[model samples]
Target: MKNAKSMSRHRVAIIAGLLLLPGFAFAQQSITVTSWGGAIAAAQQKAMQDPFTAKTGIKVIPEDYDGGLAEIQSQVKTGNVKWDVVNVEAFDALKGCDEGLFEKIGFSKLPPGDDGVPASKDFAKGLMSECGVPTDLYANVLAYDKAKFGANGPKTINDFFDLGKYPGKRALRKAPGVALEWALMADGVAPADLYKTLATPAGLDRAFKKLDTIKPQLVWWTAGAQPPQLLASGEVVMTSVYNGRIYDANVKDKRNFAIVWDGQVQIPEGWVVLKNGKKTAAALDFVRFATGTQPLAAQANIIPYAPPRTSALNNVTGATKSSLPNAGQSGRAVVSNAEFWSDNGDDINKRFSAWLAK
Candidate 1:
């Protein structure tokens, strides 16, 4: 009887050990990705999470935050990091790299080429070093209500200021992300000379003075969706809005909104891995999968935002064409200088906010 009891105890211990094995393995492999909370997040869910789990058997959980880097910094400071991978703006990516918040990625791990995207050092191997990869390219373009403008709507940034001709309410982004660039362009400064002129006090003042001309007529918008809605409701005849949001509103509401890509402010979204996470390897794999051509193409199909991968562009179907910025143009247009924004964004934002408030 004693021998039988001992044998029974040993079998129970074996069963318990087996039960705990899978849990341990699961604990070893889980990645939390952080990104902006909106359509982009939905696109990521459809394109990345479902496919990656099916292929790699790795579970992906997404965490949404308004300002991803700020949240990451808070996490790091408190020593309770929750995110493994983060979707960051290029400027924030640079800032994160400077503060040692990213890891070096291994280029060899990245999948081979994209034909649809322009060739760039923008996507290279290694963590924190080449810390971010361009995921999507969007623009802040002039969107006008076709009914309001009729056949004589604004066609460029210069036209956006001609209240006498294309008269109606106007809207612009509250952020200085592209306001300075647009201001300079409206002031007849060449795109190439925009940054050069903006570096000086006189040039910045000139830009502000140009903005002052339209201040009362301006309807400042803080949300991406606001401009399109304002335009559709006839609150504003023309507004500078994100290309994707405008496209979405146009499709869903059948509003006669058209985007003017000329002199548009291009903004590229970038993906970066977080520095303080337990699942670094898994997070890197997620980044590789998320930015890879296949997944990116899937996202472009559902949204107006274009992937930075050259090959992904070819996958964009006719159904998605209406949302693309410069759809009327033959090829891709120039991308904005993210590095310049990184260096000057804060100062410009502060000044613009103060000016607007005053």
Candidate 2:
């Protein structure tokens, strides 16, 4: 009887020892994620990092890359990729995927879908995969000072070109995506036909010719934050500006800026997993957690950005309602075609740069 009892105890000890082997222990290491540094990073730390660390007992280290894409490209070329997870712009993600700098996502391990967010997926999923999961969906809307436009506000993109009718200092992004689209729209090309026309020589010429009309009125802006400042200081009465900046100026500062959603050019931010990451599984797990409905909604609420998950949108509370784009409007707002931007972004940017220089 004594010998049999001793043998049972010895077997249990051996099993426990095997479970604590070096290989198994090493699998629990923490992961590092890289992302664009700014206000978004603060929101991520609050919504994702703290909660994930508490739940999993794994440390999450967040690093910022000021020039995110350039850093990633440098890492890839040098063959010393340090990023395990990254937040990339939609266009950058597409470019990275094409270059094989990203790993294929595995969707089977993610949480169940809530509202519009996919149930499972990890790798290069946008913040909100449905409604085009936008990390940040900012409209390059026509923002005008209520004081300037007053009772006769510019209602559409057409008004942007009618400077003769509503004259004031005007600003526009010096970049191509929205600027080109706006230029073509001002040329009387329909939104649906804008891209197609730009693809043809005549359409390109037409857009350039139309732009020439307003060129003198234009104050070219390079950064997203510049336009709102231009408006708030009364340097410009009307300009194409990011919706968030306009909202902040209007709501927080009590400025009279307003956004015209018609023909708004939406830009989406995206996320991706790095290729050859050391903690691939853990990094994917983080992605799933960060993009989960509650976390996504929470971040959106705090940051004035849209949650990517459909379920996340449902979780958005009353406090967040006032800040979201088209919050009071009927039906879902129009989102920019990420695939289109991803495909033509480089060529457009180059052309726009040349035009700006001219």
Candidate 3:
């Protein structure tokens, strides 16, 4: 009777070990991913999160935030990081990585594209970083309500600054990044020489002087979702917006917003795994899956942001293509220089705040 009892106990222990294996234990794992919410969150849920859960049995808990590094900084400084993976702008990705606030991702671990090409070759050049991998290219472009603009609406990038021609209150994000670039371009700085000129005192003065022309008419917006709302309510005639938000407003909400792609500032956005998260393994797994070619392409169909992977772009189809920032006049679109921002952001942001106070 003692021998039989021992054998049964041994068998029960083996069964428990098997149950704890990855395949069976995956359902118990969950990771939190933070993003700029609304349409982007909804798109992520449909394209990546849901499918990832189904395939790996790992749950993704989504959270929303207005863009910034303060929350991440607080979490990391206190050793209480709650976000496992975060959707970061290119500048933050570089900045956070420099500050050692994020995990150093092993790009080699990412799988090959669905087309069988290696990930290194499949993704766009300069998009993959040591700590983050870009999922898509989003643009801050000019958008206007079609009904307000009528048939002969604001056409050129310069028109966004032409109060007499387009004539009404205009909206721009309160940040200096894209707004400064737009101001420089409107002041006749060439797209290729924008950052170069903006680095100079005279150039900074020129850009600000241009902005001053519209200062009284400028309505400042701080959130990604505000541009569309500002336009829809006739609060502003034209506003600089994330292309995805304008797309969602028009397609999903049946609003008549139109995007002016000329001089659009394209920025790479992607996932960064926070350092010291409890769910590091699950977070890395989800990043690999979500940034894959198919998932990126799947997201593009829902939101207008173009996938950073060539393979993913090839896979994207449907009406969303027309609204893609890269699909328009290529010469006019400016890919933001992340390095420049990483180096100069603090100084410029302080100056911008001073200008805002004035």
Candidate 4:
């Protein structure tokens, strides 16, 4: 009788555990997603997150953070991760994964970018990573006030550095990422050898030397919005601006701005899940949903940053949205090399900073 009672109790416990396993997914009714603030967040809310809730009944709590992994590192160290999923730059996603602070993604689970192509084949090169899903695409492109130059605007990256020809104060974002790439390209560095050459000290010096040629004419901008505002007010003539900012300026604000897609450096933002978060499973589901073809395309309508999915691009309408940075970007687009930047960015930024101080 004792043996039978013990066996019966074990069976009851197993049944209870089995029942709870199915309920576990539905237990968390909400998840917090962190992203860059302003228009990007608004678009995600309308296009992705809201639709996700309506379909899965999982509430999405949206939050904003400046791009970096320091806070995430702290969260993981303290075992108190508040963000289920974070939208990070390519290098951040790469570095965070290398450090094991983020969960290693299972790329096989992601839906195809197009029906005929696998997920791995669909994304533009360097967009996919072991730890993150590529979300939206953007470019560091030059935009000029159409009122100022109109027909004779600086048309190429080479033209941007040609101070004697298109003489004026030009603005660049205060970072070594795209600016250095542009510097090398403007100095006749072939697009294919950008990172290979940048690996050498001679190449680094060459980029800085190219930058030095226009130091006096440079207006350094830290924020994305500053370039367009500065351009409208005549503070800078042609500014290195995000394509979306230029899109907003022309379509929404009625500012006379035109983007020079030539020599544009494309950067893809990623969505990452932190390790050991309670909501990790749900977060993965949300990322899978948010990065789908239609959802990504919907985001393009709200903001001009291209969708990473090739199928998503098919859903985008209008000439403005159609021309977003992509794989076939007219031979002038350089996809940012996340691995190289992850390896060398800190040291490069230090050198770039010292040069700026001097």
Candidate 5:
């Protein structure tokens, strides 16, 4: 369960081709960076993308897309990959690398972070990978309207399922990613045993059964911007959201939203070079600059997600760090398993899709 005070998280999704890294001429050549087109992308632009361009005198173009693999796969398959660098979810990064859709990045190319921690050692566990370099450490958290629930709001993941007590419509992402894990968690699965339980047919059925309880009252969102809007307009009293969206709303918009980090599922997003792109050199350079200690840390100051590099935490404002999903006071948190999702996602995706169709 998540409160409305702060929200930041990314889920696994998306892909694309590689080419030679071309030289940049300050105002001439540019590499298009693709990411979700919400506050998430805005924060990245403010913290990394724009600054990177300013610092290197390289032009950077931003683009948006729903978190899907079809586009990227098509680009790579057709050998017309347009994106020099792609920001993808962790599981997609793993799947892409496994399918040879991404360039195999090695640790040697990554320099030590500003804090002096080696890139290989600096990133949080499960972040350093073969294809993608971890860029953001986020948590899919629950946020609620304070006025609706008053002082006694839904405080735990279990409470999200207790419709009788909460008495309101709920919002969650339409995809299967963390929705299944949350269902199992609310049904009493321990954090440590979540994947193991979900791996079993009985466990899978149990999760779906739990989700069935909230099906009629559920409102699903397809974009990161929708969750906060749902709560703001009171269409849904409570909704699952990225930690940064709620954080920005609470800080900038002055909304009475609370974020409950309990049962928050942590996810790390990464930037990868498309093997079919023409700018392998420039793409790798951008990835390194963006994921470096200073840039990664700077991104957190503008948003609520924790930085992947431990060193970057030092740069985040106290207010931001305190509300992170992994903070000690934020309650129990679990990292999403990239390998499990990468391997079984296709099958589970179909099942989730079928259930939604029904």
Candidate 6:
């Protein structure tokens, strides 16, 4: 009888262990997401995170960072990752995936669009990648204080470089990514040949040489928020700025600013999951919901960055349409070459830094 009792207790213990398995599998409660802060973060908070929490019962902890791979790399290398999901630019997504810093995203798992199109087909062409899902489209655009140039403001790509024509301090982002492309274009490199030209040594020098013309009069900006501020303070007459920021300055803050759509360098931004994050399942669910048609469109309503989803773009209408990167872009825009930047960013950034210091 004692032996029989012992066996029954052991069986009961085994049964209890089996009962807890499902709880363990479904226990995810919260996740952390990181992105570039400021208006973009506020827009995401309203459009994505708040709704996701209401739907999933999973709390999202938001964090901000200046754009780069350093923080993610340290978290991944140290195995103490705090961020489950991060918003990354296209080149960073490609480089991070290639370096195994981010989890491989399975597009098949994402829900179809509201229009019933598959996620794979619904996203814009050449944007789907192995480890990230494209969320929105933005551009580095030439924006100026309309009051500074009046109606005769800098019109063409050439005019941005023509100090003698529209002479004043011009603010350029201190990065080589768009600056080099703009330099080459200002020097008359055709849009179709931009990447090919930037690929060679002589072409690289040519871009830097062109930049040298405006170097004396150039005021460098490092943050997205700074350009609008610079223009407001009259520190610079014109600056290359993110489309959304300048748009907000005009429509929201009532600053008199205008975008010169010529030579806009448009690029896609996406959501990426950190490799080996503790909340991988929850992180991916958040990414799916955040990149969905409604969420992408919702963000565009708050800011002018275009949605990358075909279905989501349909939802964007009214005043936001006039602020988009594609507005008045004509045929003079360059879609950023993500692969070229992914491969060469580090080397070019180093050269750019050395030049900046001199």
TM-score list, all predictions: 0.83, 0.77, 0.94, 0.86, 0.91, 0.91
Worst 10 residues of 5 by lDDT: 10-19
| Candidate lDDT values, in order | 0.73, 0.69, 0.90, 0.85, 0.83, 0.89
- Give the winner by lDDT: 3
Who is ahead in lDDT, 2 or 3?
Answer: 3
In terms of TM-score, which candidate is strongest? 3
Better of 1 and 3 by lDDT: 3
Positional deviation of 101 in candidate 4, in angstroms? 1.6
- Model 5: per-residue Cα lDDT over 129-232, one tens digit each: 89988888788888998988788887888888998888789999998888988999898889999999989999888988999999999999998889989999
In candidate 1, what residue range of length 10 has the lowest lDDT sum? 120-129
Give the clashing residue pairs of candidate 2, or none: 113-119, 115-311, 116-310, 116-311, 117-310, 128-133, 128-308
**Candidate 4 C-alpha lDDT tens digits along 1-358:** 9999999999999877865886444544799999977667887899999999888878899988767788999998899999999999899899999889898875687877646677777776657889989888788998898899879998889988998998889999888998899999998899899998899999999999999999999999876668889999998889898888877777779888988888898888889999979988789889888888878888887887888777887788865566577635654778888889999988998998998999
Q: How many residue-pair clashes does candidate 4 contain?
A: 0
Per-candidate clashes come to 14, 7, 0, 0, 27, 0
Worst 10 residues of 3 by lDDT: 324-333
Off by over 4 Å in 4: 1-28, 112-126, 327-331
Is candidate 1 or 5 superior in TM-score?
5
Residue 55 in model 5: lDDT? 76
Misplaced by over 4 Å in model 3 are 1-15
Cα miss at 124, model 2 (Å)? 15
lDDT preference between candidates 1 and 5, better one: 5
Screening candidate 4 with a backbone cut-off below 3 angstroms (N, C-alpha, C), the clashing residue pairs are none
TM-score leaderboard ranking: 3, 6, 5, 4, 1, 2
Q: Over the stretch 1-358, how does candidate 2's per-residue lDDT look in tens digits? A: 9999999999999978976885444345677876554456766778887888777756878888643366777776777878777876666666677777776653554675554445643222443332112345545678888887687898878788887787877888766667778877766677677767877878777787888888888898765567778987888878987676776566567887877777676666755777766777777777778767777777777666666556776777846566666465322134555666667777767776787788
What's the C-alpha lDDT at position 272 in model 6? 97
Candidate 3: tens digits of C-alpha lDDT, residues 17-89: 9887876777878899999999999999999999999999999999999887899999988989999999998
lDDT of 6 by residue, 99-162 (tens): 9999997679788889999988888889878998898889988988988779999887778899
Candidate 6: which stretches are off by over 4 Å? 1-28
